[model samples]
Target: MTDILGYRAKFGVLGPSTNTTVQPEMDEMRPAGVTNHYSRIIVDNANALSDETFLKGTALIDQGTVDAVRGVMTCAPDYLVMGMSAITFYGGAKGAEQWQSNIEEVAGVKSFIGSVSVVEAFKAIGGIKKVAFLSPYYPVANTEVRNFLSDYGFETVADHPFRAPTWTAIAEITHKQVREVVEQMNDDNVDAILQVGTNLCMARLAGRLEQELNKPVVAINTATYWHALRANGITDKVSGFGRLLEEL
Candidate 1:
């Protein structure tokens, strides 16, 4: 029999079908004996981003999540990770909790979701209370992120929204653009700089920014994966992603 690699843990990652960055970022951070398997929540239309359009897209994602969860469960993963962020951050902290509950109910497995993962990441990093964040979401979604963080007791010191034209455009955002947003958001009062939107591809950039800014620069993908590994009791301490994976 062929040797199966992920004898330690198999992570089932769920993302929107239109997202192009989460799977690649997760694969880049995969440690020895830890494998990542993906299942996409189908998004039939890639419409221009707006409050109305974004909410509609999230509804589609919600509709598709159960089926995607079912499909990934067939892999018999040791844990689950939600690679998308919007839905989890939609209502607030309570909304995130309910979303997780729904996932556990349907998938019959515990999972690491973006909203809760980021909160846990903050706690792991010494209970940082002030933060700056960047996102490719519309104004409404960004508000939800702020609300969710506020509910967790962290104050958003500053926020930058890319307002990417479409779901696909979120993946097209360049590292230079992301760096500029991070630079614009940073200040002495900001304890950390958070990059939301898994499709924004900020993992490596977050590491570099952390060195430059001398503070935590957390990428959602990195935080989500880190939460999964630690929650599963696999503390392999990955490098190059960010301090979340390396130190915490």
Candidate 2:
């Protein structure tokens, strides 16, 4: 039998333990009968981070993913939503495929991952060539995201990195902080701007900016969840987050 509230579809979402942003942002975008079940990949808050330490911390989160998957699989979710983005962008497009393939194999179901989902969103929206991005990650992780996007034939005209010192600090990034970065990255040559870190909480800002900037302001959480719903054949046309959900 299907879950009571999730009779339409139950998405098993996986993210780092220190993430407090993706869940709420995603819930606000959910359509009727679609429910989100989150399973945290346990990791101590990486407080005092540099490029080296940040890599180590993310490695810990990577190690915990399978256990998180098993925990969520108990609900028999119809699909998986990988709420983390850094790890998926680690080895470029081919590496993203392998990472997601492992998760899907473990969950025994189809899955939607953040990195690839954002690429799909760009494709659906069409004609997005040069791009810029902002991230809560250190330069190390940002390199991976750039590489992943480059693999998909998108060029990085400009990008910004917040290098949030702790996993929790990523969620602490303010709207003003993001807009400042957007202002810095905004260029006539860049057709779209993207925010990569899921915990950075940019979906709402992204949607609002698209109107103000007259360009696609793509947020990872919005892209991933929108990919999940659309790939599952649920065409709800969710609003508020961005055009990816509201129109495409």
Give candidate 1's TM-score: 0.96
Candidate 2 residue-wise lDDT, 1-248, digit = tens: 77789988999999999999989999998999999999999999976468888888888989999999999999889999999989999999999999989988898999999999989999999999899999999899888988999999999999898989899999999999999999999989999999998899899999999999999999999999999999888999877877898899
Which residue pairs in candidate 1 have backbone atoms (N, alpha carbon, C) closer than 3 angstroms, thus clashing? Answer: none
Cα lDDT tens digits for candidate 1, 19-47: 99999999999999898999998886567
In lDDT terms, how accurate is model 1? 0.89
lDDT score of residue 15 within candidate 2: 93
Candidate 1: 10-residue stretch with minimal lDDT: 1-10
lDDT by candidate, in order shown: 0.89, 0.92
* RMSD to the hidden true structure, all candidates: 1.5, 0.9
